[model samples]
Target: MKKTLIAYFTRTGITKKLAENTAKQTGADLFAIEPVKEYSSSYLICVGQAKLENLQNARPAMKAKPQNLQDYDTIVVMFPIWWFTCPNIILT
Candidate 1:
């Protein structure tokens, strides 16, 4: 059987939920994009961290990167939009 990959990042789970739906429909393997350093779930802290990173032009490193990228012909990337932008810097 062929396999597919669906990688996603969600701070508040909205995008996570959507990714799940896509996976369900497509029978794809889902992987969460997590940072090397976990952060508090608090909205205040999330905002602060985002701002700090943006100010420093720093991208929080991810805990893991996609391995065996060629194994899956279909790769679906799902993430949330913050400040009217998708933070591409978080891609690892």
Candidate 2:
């Protein structure tokens, strides 16, 4: 059987919940793509930061990453849309 991985970045808990459900159904390993510097809890503040990052074409640093990515035959990435695209951290 091919090994699968579900990697996700979530600001609110919504995307995390979806990733967890998908992982359960697919029997895949879960990896949280966290940023080294967390965004502000306030939605407005976060939006501002995300907008700036987008304008700068930034790739925020991650706190952790999956090892041996070659081991997984399939990898699913999930994240909420920020500035009409995935958050900058997802690029890390």
Model 1, clash count? Answer: 0
Candidate 2, after superposition: displacement of residue 53 in Å? 0.6
In terms of lDDT, the best-performing candidate is 2
Q: Clashes in each model (backbone N, CA, C under 3 Å)?
A: 0, 0
Report per-prediction Cα RMSD to one decimal.
1.9, 0.8
Off by over 4 Å in 1: 1-3
lDDT of each: 0.80, 0.92
On residues 1-92, what C-alpha lDDT tens digit does candidate 2 reach at each position? 79999999888889999999999998999999999999999999998998999889899999987999999999999999875778899887
lDDT per residue as tens, model 1, 9-91: 98778989999999999899998898877655997987787777778877778888889888998888888876776553454
Candidate 1 TM-score, C-alpha based:
0.83
Worst 10 residues of 2 by lDDT: 83-92
lDDT of 1: 0.80
Query: TM-score of each candidate?
Result: 0.83, 0.95
